[model samples]
Target: MAASKIAIYGAIGANVAIAVTKFVVAGITGSSAMLSEGIHSAVDTFNGVLLLVGIRLSQRPATAEHPFGHGKELYFWSLIVAVLIFGLGGGVSFYEGIQHIRHPEPMRDATWNYVVLGLAALFEGTSFFIALREFRREARGRPFWQALDQSKDPTTYTVLAEDSAALAGLGVAALGIWASHRFDMPALDGAASVVIGLLLAGVAVLLISQARGLLIGEGIRPETARAIRSLAMQQPSVQDVGRVLSMYIGANEVLAIVDVNFKDGTATGEAADAIAAIEQQVRARFPMIRRLFIEASEAPVDAAATA
Candidate 1:
């Protein structure tokens, strides 16, 4: 979470400064691509704020009405951020590009656009590296795509995705600006804006998919579940392990319920002790399992039926 905060803060600061500069340059040069980039940065800044709000809200304590706490708040806000990117960012950029293409206006000198773009690249690049570093650290030694697929925390990856899109948008904007000046064709700049809009829309769709999955209650990986089942089976009083159900209640919190069948003659006291021991061992191995429920069941009719 600390890493998430650092990445988001860096992004917000960089985007705020770059958005202002891009808008100023766009105003002076009347460059459609630059204006679109400005809108992108502004939208990113606001998205960063929404992420922060999500993080804060997700930290709220669990209550009677909400037994799982407010952890899903982060996923909810992440979805909203993706929607805003698609709407305010991508929609506006696409519209602006079409308008510019229809009413092609000659651009002013390209010197300021180049200078501003260079600075924007530097700032945006720094933020991107920061986010990538944090994400990689969290991923440990896992493959990038695999780690991303299993990640429960939305803030870290969301920033990484946004920065990645921002960097790509910058490249597109730079190329479009150069092409317009070199060919003396202003419509190319609008074309660049269109490309950027499509890029953002693509990123938003991916983000929405991920956030939606988490918001609806994603579970731990199959490997983790199998490991946990094995751990439960290792208990002497346990005859077999049945269902091992798990769900992520927060970024670092998990709630798991396991059905264990005990030996037919096992005393209730012995079952209780075994359950306590099992809980301790599981929690020791996977500290993220904040809440665990172990249900004792009758001996399985089919001993081969295991989780």
Candidate 2:
């Protein structure tokens, strides 16, 4: 966990500095779009920092009071980052766009603006690609965002989402900056900023939804359910599987409650042995599973019964 956070911290530091430079350039040139991108980068810095804090706190060892540890703090803090992105980045960009429409200012030192914008674009691209490479090694089979969207681990997903968004934002900013200078239409820059704002807001909404699911103890993926059910049913002594309930207890880790039904003729102690054996098998197959609590039932418990 500590190792994971180091990279995020580096990214945050880079973004904060990049944002400062972006704002300085934007202010000198009076380019609304550059200003919007600058604000967006600042929000990125905050999000990255918050993600680090969340990931750090979540790694605390489980205690008697927090049997589940502080893992949920990652989700809570990541959600807060999302809210900040929306309220701060999105809100400011929208207002700037509206302001530009009513009383637009002529951009100055446009040549200098291009140089600064180009450097910022390169920095953003480097950061974005680094994030993609980080996840690429693990996300080969899964689509780019699919793993992130379905991930239960808050810290990991937040970092991935933030990186992806940063890359996209840079591209948007580049277009806005170029169009504003190319066509001598400064308003286009502000329009691009507005579009970037919408994109950031969309990402924020997505982050919040994922966090909400974790907070409310969303069920494990269907594939997880099937994996649990199929594996338990494979046990020789198991007659049936009653129900399998799984919840994410850490980033990509799950705790499962499994009900196993053995033959009615079997002794209770024997059934207990069967359940224990099945649990061991489950752990062997799914190492990411952190907890497995089995309920031995002689007769199978149906889905309705468990519900």
Candidate 3:
């Protein structure tokens, strides 16, 4: 629903159009490089559609069955997208490129191929810039790779990955088309395709790593842990926290479980009610945390707590 999401849809829309055009041109030209590039773009279009669907479904409101919300599902779908990109786009392209390199073929009307590649590059460049703009906006005051690492916003991650891949693919297409045109050596085109395949594989690895972290319920940074510690001490019944554990359950949801030392010899019934109250307070203060459980701990005083 955000502006960046709309921009991603535009990128997706353009890719579908470009993929169709590229496929027709590649078939007409009988160029293996062009065919590989077409397949690459076609896969990209599919990836974009998958991202859009993931983004949409991930936004669904929480249900009774999934009281924590349906956020982790996004990570699962994103991981699947990554696998598809690597296997379908990268593997297929690598195989086709090797075949072309071994057995050269005559190409017809290289001009149209070059023209389409250039035009598609221009469009894809625009889309990449839009994604970059959003990335920069959200990643303000942080290193680029760090921002990419810490960004929990699904839309940013999905669109950023797709557009980055799309723009790079465009570059590869252009280089291959130009090389094949210049020397009339189809092998250069094939080599370019090999490079494109590697790029896709690299991007796939990135997506999968990030998605895997999310699926495993990785927690926020130590700073967030510190914030929670400070808030826990504010509860009058809680003397000090003993053991704390927290993991991110969604973009804005953390699953928090705490072991705290309440005042010694406090009334058992009162202590039970007090622990429940502390849990509610923690959840209220940190709306991002969906679940909180407080258990009593008998331990020595330690000012510092880790989550």
lDDT of 1 by residue, 12-103 (tens): 99999999999999999999999999999999999999999999999999999998898889899999999999998899998999999999
Q: Cα RMSD for candidate 3? A: 5.5
Candidate 2 deviant stretches above 4 angstroms: 140-146, 299-307
Relative to the true structure, candidate 1 has a C-alpha RMSD (angstroms) of 4.2
Sorted on TM-score, best first, the list reads 1, 2, 3
Backbone clashes, each candidate? 0, 1, 0
Superposition-based RMSD of candidate 2 using all C-alpha atoms, in angstroms:
4.8
Pairs that collide in candidate 2 are 153-251
Please write out the lDDT profile of model 3 over residues 1-307, one tens digit for every residue: 3755766677787778788888899889876667777787788778777767776777788899987777776677778888988998888888888888898776677889878888888877877778778778767679988887778766677777776776777678678868877898888778877887888889888888888888887886787677777777776767787656887766666788878787765556556666767777677766777778777785333333321
Query: How far in Å is the alpha carbon of 28 misplaced in model 3?
Result: 2.7
Using all chains and alpha carbons, the TM-scores for the candidates as numbered come to: 0.94, 0.89, 0.82
TM-score of 2: 0.89
Best by lDDT: 1
TM-score top scorer: 1
